[model samples]
Target: MSRVKFELPADDLTRATAFYREVFGWETQRLPFEYVLVDTDGEPVDPADADGGISPRTRFVQGPVLIIEVPDVDEVAGKVAAAGGELLNAKERVGEYGFSQYVKDSEGTVLCLWQSIADGTAAV
Candidate 1:
């Protein structure tokens, strides 16, 4: 399971939901602020179980991006810069739980790096 997730941009939640529904066959459920949860088709995961659910603990940003995990954020941050992708933010610890950062690809698309409590490492 990946520690990271992606949220696509939407100008109109209902219109976007309908489009994605036809395009990907994914069911979107509304939350607050016109945000929708992209429904997964597999068995519903329970957050109470260790490896059964989405990390209810991690924070997610609202935008279309890739989620990656890595062992050390500082190391990856350097690599991102060296690779010509600009690092948008330094790694930030969210309490004792995990850390995250933002970066932009060569085309300027933003991507997020996610680290979780389980491995204390960021996902790539």
Candidate 2:
């Protein structure tokens, strides 16, 4: 699609933000509710094309799980299972913005699947 955003889990927001900023030179914004937004200053690239020293083979489970936009969370979740992957949880509403679900591929790399809900209604 056009854009993709990644969500990283951190126990210490301050420390994590500082680490990214100091180590990688990424600009970070401390948002409300202890959420620190990291600006990578570049579009999301495929692991295969990334040259930040992370091997593409382990990139899926190494750090931040990639968030890919999809049209239907449920449909993609079903496809994931059919393709030998496992869903970590059922699709759920994302604060009226969309629905999301965590899934692990056959290689055990967890990623998030997101589907936007245009009408603000929960999608079945």
Candidate 3:
């Protein structure tokens, strides 16, 4: 299994975090520097079995952004572009927080690539 996950980037981590906390009532865990983790509870989901009990109506779970834990942001950036995706931003340090970049998928939908330098782990 691939350790992939999705992350929603913000121009201002503090402000975005606060806005989400108040508006969505989400729990935020401050990591090193300005990086923070939005706490969420994951539950089993099956679109085909919507009538089953695993649905949200039956099992209440926190459905957050689908974060893909990638390996190399730089390499993936190339793959993304070559695969019909466009690089919106080059890989750069996220201040003292970590490293991040942006890209637009084939459909022109922008997304973020997250990398945690502290632990040497990455996500995109």
Candidate 4:
């Protein structure tokens, strides 16, 4: 089954991580490029949990975006326009681990699709 994750933008990493820690009991770890990974379930973070990254608020993402894992980024992306959604950008490599792309649904909700490196298909 496909896994779903959420990505949220934060203005402050230190404060944001601290708030999530204190309020939701979620644990967070700092990542390279000033991103933070939040473990909403309190589980020890796995090495491949890059989808949970909380990045600084940016022009493309001023709010929360859902990250859905798929088997193939290009295949799903090809259906966006026909489904009445707009492809925000083409898929780009995420550290040799996966590819990520942004899209906007018919209802205007922005989302990110992630295709992870296959272990024949890795667990989320």
* Candidate lDDT (C-alpha), each: 0.58, 0.64, 0.53, 0.80
Q: What tens-digit string does per-residue lDDT give for candidate 1 at 3-73? A: 45555666566777678668766655554333455654533322211121112212233455675666567
Best by TM-score: 4
lDDT of 1 at 121: 53
On lDDT, the leading prediction is: 4
Better of 1 and 4 by lDDT: 4
Cα lDDT for residue 70, model 1?
61
Query: How does model 3 fare in lDDT?
Result: 0.53
Structural similarity to truth (TM-score) of each candidate? 0.52, 0.65, 0.53, 0.85
Q: Can you write out model 3's per-residue Cα lDDT over 31-75, one digit (the tens) per residue?
A: 545455654432232221111111111011122233333456787
Candidate 1 Cα deviation (angstroms), residue 61 = 6.0
TM-score head-to-head 2 vs 3, winner = 2
Could you tell me which residue pairs clash in candidate 4?
A: none
lDDT of prediction 1: 0.58
Residue 70 alpha-carbon offset, candidate 2, angstroms: 0.7
Task: Return whichever of 2 and 3 wins on lDDT.
Answer: 2
After superposing candidate 3 on the true structure, give the runs of residues whose Cα lies further than 4 Å from its correct spot.
1-25, 29-36, 41-67, 120-124
TM-score: model 4 vs. ground truth = 0.85
lDDT, candidate 1, at 120: 44
